[model samples]
Every structure is written in structure tokens, then in C-alpha cells.
Target: MLVKDIMQDIGETKKKDTRFTNRLIPFHDVCSVSSGDIDNAIKSAGKEYLKDGSQAAGQKFMGVVKIRNNNTVNKESIINSIGDIFTKNHTVDLNDPDFTIIVEVFRNVCIVSVLTDYIKLRKFNIFGLFSGGFAEPKKSIHKDP
Candidate 1:
């Protein structure tokens, strides 16, 4: 251990932020949807969740209008892609929502659900997911001994 090692770096946790054993880290840059992708994602979110096979609505493709990136386990970027589906005029009342569509473009996986208020959720298939993620068989991951 060197003397410099003991010195703290910027944003390092201090005594105030600690909560028992877990040190409360000052919020760091999160992996949320980039500003550019927000508009289409939100809009896509709304339409995909609405009635089945609802093609992209005519709602103007306004870019991601709002960004509230925080520490959500599932990166907001993934959600934002679907979020882009919403229009500004569209009302999204979390309490009693019409529908909630989750589009994972990366894996070409879309989960659609008609909302019974935001709390209750059930899944249905909408558009065929076009995204794809890396696939590896367990055997391929490691060579047999």
C-alpha cells in the first residue's frame, strides 16, 4: 500500500453517505437511453401496448422530450427505445394507464400488455420482435476438458 493509495479521488464516498456496511455512492452516470432515441422509443411504447398490430401512429416523431435517467436496474436506454413510441399529446397516467409496451430492440423482443392501471400487468404478443442478442450454447462457452 502506498501513500497515494490512501488518498481519496473525486466523488469518493465520505462518512456522510454511508448506510451501515453499504456505502451510499454519489449517483454516477447511468446507462439510460441517449437523448436522441427517447422520442421514438416512448411513442413506440404507447402504440405497441395499445390494440394489437397498431402500426406506428402518425403522432409527430418528436425526439426524447424528457430525460429522467436514474439508477434503474434495467437500463433506461432499453425502455427509452420503446418510450420513443409516445407522442407529446398522449397522456400517460401511471395510476390508470391504457397499456404498457416494453420493446427490447436489441434482442428484437417486445412485450405488450393492456394496462389495468399501472400496477396490474399481463403480457401479450404484438409485433414480431426484430432484435437479436448474442446466443451461445453452454458447451460452446467453455471447451470440454
Candidate 2:
């Protein structure tokens, strides 16, 4: 099965849970490619993402691209390569981004995908959740008067 199909299936399954509202889908076109072609693959994927954006001016938004290097290619080299591409051709925001692009590189091939619409996961405040910043609603028990 295609990676897209797998992602869609996972999204559908996750939607059954009430907590998950936004279904983050990875926009991918080509499935596999050589490790050396990472930059081209990302560029193609980014362009496709821009084309799909309905808003005029191709939807002005910020995002960061990451590479998960599981192959022989040095991780630093991958980071630098992706960083150069972004700096030279695209604008990215690290603090708050509308989306995230990830490239998972294996020995023979790599996968590129754009991710967005993480409403629930984004809103979660780890510090607050751990520090009791949110409280559960209390139920009142009534006694016969």
C-alpha cells in the first residue's frame, strides 16, 4: 500500500477518539528516492504543497523541515543540506510554524512529507498538565432533604 493510504487509514482510526479533532495528513507525492535526491524531493513536495494551498499568494505560512537519518549519510550533512535549501529557496519559522516537513532517510531511499492541522497536540501544555493547571469538573452528591 502507498504511504498516503497508510496515513489516511491511521487518520480515520484516530478520528474515532473524541480528543483528536484535526487529522494531520502528510502531503506526499513520490514515495521513494535515493538519499542524494533529498533536496530535490523536498523542493518538489514544497511546491506541490504551495499549489494545493487555496488561499491567494499560496497561503503565507511558516514551517520547519526535519530529516530523520537512518542511513549512512551523516546526520549533520543532512541537516545542513536541508537548511541550505530552506534558506536559499523558502522561508521558515522556528518559534511558531503552521506546518512541519519531515524527511525520513533509509539506506536506499527517503520519504518526504508535509504535516499540518495538529490542533489538540499543539494546544497541549506539558508544564500545565503536569503542574495541575487544569482541573476536572466536580460532581455534586445530593442528600435527601
Candidate 3:
């Protein structure tokens, strides 16, 4: 299913300087990567991420991230590489759980969310999480309220 499909409408309202409103879906709009453009974005970011001079984890994180907008991320090949990245090291969940990865999609752009979670986070201020999910809303997004 698409990310927008699961998002529950939270009604449109103004926040700060922008007229903001969300289709508030089950998943947190902080780690989503739209299938529409993420193919290319994944490729580009993955290359840079792999060359960041840090130890690669290689954990093959497979799933879809939720978000409010999809226009702030590079769409093309970032997601695909990140998914494959796990297979090389497999330490993604054990080490880099902070900066909760999320994606926001809005027609022409994909906004990746470097999320801050109150649980299961290993690193703080790591808001530059280079992670994102597909249109599918995993169980994590939808929780019983």
C-alpha cells in the first residue's frame, strides 16, 4: 500500500509560517521514502553514505518509512542501496537506531525525516538518519491509541 493510503487525515491547519495539515497516517511521518522517486535518491545517498569514513553496518533494513512531505529528499537510488547496505555488515539495528529514519512525500519531492524517538535509540542528535522506507506502512507506523 502507498504511504498516503494509511495516513489518517489530521485536518489542515496553519503552523508557524506555513499552512500545514497532514493526512496523519498510522506511521510517524518521520521516516518515509516514497517509491515514486526513492529509486534514484537511494543510489546517490548510498554512495555518499558508504564513503562517509565510518564503519559500515550492513543490515539490509527492509520496510517503508512514513512522512508528511516527500519533497525534501533525493529520489533515485538512496533507498535501494541502504537496503543492500545491511547485507554487507548487518549492524544497522544494533548500532545506528537513532535518528529514526522517516520519509515524507509530496508529489514532486521526497522529504526524508531524521526522526527522534523516545525508545530504542542508540545515538542522540543523529537526526541525519540516511534511511527511508517504501509506500508500505509497517506495523510500527500504526499503533493502537
Candidate 4:
């Protein structure tokens, strides 16, 4: 909600302003890394965004976006774990997914959410949207050599 309002305000401004904010990424839930909290948080968020009957069976494409600041957490492990939750029902489309599961691990906590327009919103970067820059090239989970 707050991000939406900020985007609207930026849109209303005639002049492009780049100093106020840099980015605004929203999350549905936050939890500590201990006691399987990360898994629980992602599970809860998945239920809300990837509800059954939302699309035809096996037709929904989902992707995972993970950013880890904590060295203790393995990025691939987290991404694969989250992917396990929806793999049975959806296909993986890193280039352009219908829904994206975001897992941000910072120190001892993790923030999780599902975003439908992550790519369309310039990956939720306020500055990118305001600057009218070219859309970023599609990203893949695997790094290309």
C-alpha cells in the first residue's frame, strides 16, 4: 500500500526527482532464522499468493528471488526449499513469472513475500521507475558464463 502511494506521488510530480528514495520493496511477512521460521514465513506467504484455483492446473509460472546478507544462509538452499512448496503445482519461469517469491535474509531475520508485478515494477525500485530508464534485461536463477 505504501509503495503504491509513493509510486502514485512520483507519477504526479511533473519533474523527475531522484533524491527522495531509492527503492521500495514490500514484504508480506517477517520472521527470525531460528526454529524453522523462514520456512514457516514463506509457507504462509505462498498460501496467500499461490492459492488453489487461481489459474488453470499446472499453468501458473512462479519464480524465486533471493537476496542474502547473512553468510550462514545458503541462497540456493533457500530458493530450492521455497520452490519445493509450489513445484508440484506450477512451472518455473525465471524470465517472466506470474508470481515471484522473494526471500531476503538479513542477519538473523528473513523477509518473505509474493509479488505479481515484480519485473513490471522495475523490480520495485522507485528510482528506476521515476527515471524512465530502459527495463532491465530478464534475469535467470542460474548465472550465465
RMSD of each: 19.6, 13.3, 13.0, 5.1
Report, for every candidate in turn, its global Cα lDDT versus the true structure: 0.29, 0.46, 0.34, 0.69
Kindly list the per-residue Cα lDDT of model 4 for residues 27-132, writing each as its tens digit. 8899987537877888788785457776533534555555556677777778778778777767777676667788877788788887766676677777766776
Q: How do all models score by TM-score?
A: 0.26, 0.47, 0.32, 0.75
Predicted candidate 3 versus true structure: per-residue lDDT over 68-90, tens digit per residue: 43455543345444556434533
Candidate 4, position 133, lDDT: 41
Clash tally, candidates in order: 20, 0, 49, 0
Better of 3 and 4 by lDDT: 4
In candidate 3, how many clashes are counted?
49
- Which ranges of candidate 3 are over 4 A from the true structure? 1-36, 46-48, 58-64, 67-82, 92-99, 113-145
lDDT of 3: 0.34
* Predicted structure with the largest TM-score when compared to the true one: 4
In model 4, the runs with Cα more than 4 Å from the true position are: 8-18, 56-68, 133-145
Candidate whose lDDT is highest:
4
lDDT tens per residue, model 1, 11-123: 13222222242211111112224334433434334444334345433322211112233333245554444443453334333333333333222222222222221122111
lDDT for residue 23 in candidate 1, whole number 0-100:
19
Better of 2 and 3 by TM-score: 2
